[model samples]
Target chain A: MKATPARDQETVDKWEVQLRKGCLELAILAALWEGKLYGLEILRQLESDSDLIVSEGTVYPLLSRLKVLGLVKSEWVESEAGHPRKYYALTPAGKKRALEMAGIWTRFSSSMGKLLAPLGKGNK
Target chain B: MTMADDVQQRDAQQSMEAYLGRLRRRLRGMNDEDAREIVEELRSHIRDKAAASGQVTASGVDAALAALGSPEELASQYLTDDLLARAEVSRSPVRILESLFRWASLSVAGFLVLLGSMVGYFLGVVFILVAALKSFHPRTAGVWVLPNGADDFNISVRLGFGSAPLEGREVLGWWIMPIGLAAGCALVMLTTRFAIWCVRQYRKSRALPRG
Candidate 1:
């Protein structure tokens, strides 16, 4: 039976939602691990590197939560323009977690690759 | 400065101050230095926007305020993905339910204690016992009891050269029942909405590709 358009769209949305939910924490930690950044700078970097876009509303609460968990630390530094900017850097614990998440991603990708290898070879 | 110009400047400063006040309240519990920096940055932005408009009128101030949006909305834009993930983790339904249950239990217990003190020791003891039993088996006992029929209770009295009788005094009207039910339903709806909002925020933050 042919799937209706609405059903197909719903399936796609569900997969996208699952993928986003699964990777959000890893992405955030990885970004911070590279270097400390203020909110706007992080957004700019993300825009330059990938398709991901985040709003300040989502970022602030997340930062508060991570700070509570001791995964990240933040400080205020004077900007060249004389305004103070809050800069966030990864804590040691956060760095460790980032490494662990990266390992998991690598293993999962490899497993999926193995499962799809026969199909890839057949196509070749 | 002309009278009109003075008024315009005052309005602009007032609007900026009000917006900053709101942002500060929302940013409570952050490092003091960080909070101050955020305030300064926002202040600078408002000043720049106002200057760019070239006319410091009430309308220009309003325009700058509108551009900033509500404090909550602006603050959300500045949040990092890690913060969003943390918010999602804490917004669990189980956590909310646990908090609600605790609050309800405390309120009910306090009410019962106050009633018992005003009435009598025996009544208070009885209430405590009943509350304990109900709490242990909330599903079986229900949260509250309602009189099945109001018509059965009555009072009759004879005074000097007169007789009076009162009957079917409604302690709670039928309309009150629906109102209470609506209030309870609203509370549940609000809690669910908040949880959903937290989840959506988390997903949005996560979906943003990392640098």
Candidate 2:
């Protein structure tokens, strides 16, 4: 039996959900580690660098939660566009945590890659 | 406007306003201009989508929202990972403690209320009977009052197995016992109702789609 378009879309959506759930934190941290950025700038950076599709909704809540935890501090900066942008910077603790997360992510991805290696070889 | 036109216009307007309201709330503590700009950008995107679709439907609103995701998650991406970690840690401990306290307190209070009501009902019935016998017989009054009163008497009764008093009067004044019983019933009813409301609110909040 052929998979319907809706069923295929549902499968893709589930995969996207899992992917987003797993890596969203790491992606956000990596984006902010470089320099202070506003929400839009961060969104743009994530899309450009990792091809990770994130919604504005996901980013905002995570930021608030982070701020409450005292990991990141935000400041309103006057912009040329006449809007004061909220720029987020990593605290000292944030930087240390980011490094740790990066290490963990590297180990996890490499392990997963190795596990999938057999499948790719078998297909070939 | 025609009925269809009116409905479509209203829907588009409502959707735009709702998104803007959410965006504004999400961007609280940030600069207002930044928040407004974000809202405008989202509004324009939603309008464009609505125009392309030609008719406003629930699906259109959902699609527009899907494009935006939830405001909370959008803000989260701008936060540092350490912040997320801290939030996860800070929130869990406090919430767990709070829920634990709430459940424990409610359970104890409920048990006390139930026990108090049962005791109150027995006392109420006995009081009415004693008051009846005292007024009617007058002769066997001492007999009925003394022995029956001993059982109904809420003096501190120590059980052999327990360290605490098994039976005791809550109020010092015997006259106030009825009032205390009424108050206990009221307290239990109010607490049960509040607990139910809280459960409903929890369920409702959970039912909401998260980002």
Model 2 TM-score (2 dp): 0.45
DockQ, candidate no. 2:
0.19
TM-score, each model? 0.49, 0.45
Q: After superposition, how far is residue B171 of candidate 2 from its true place, in Å?
A: 21
Give a tens-digit lDDT track for model 2, residues A1-124.
9999999998887776666656776787789997898776776688789767766555655665566566688777776544366678888888887899999989998999999999999998
Once model 1 is optimally superposed onto the true structure by TM-score, how far is the C-alpha of residue B167 displaced, in angstroms?
A: 20
lDDT of 2: 0.54
Determine which window of 10 residues in candidate 2 chain B has minimal summed lDDT.
B139-148
Compare the candidates by TM-score and give the number of the best one. Answer: 1
lDDT of 2 by residue, B1-211 (tens): 5788778677767766876786566455444664565565556445544444566554576676776666544432322222224434653333322332323333344234334444544444444443344334332321111122555653321111223233342232333334434554554454444433443333222212233
Candidates, DockQ: 0.19, 0.19
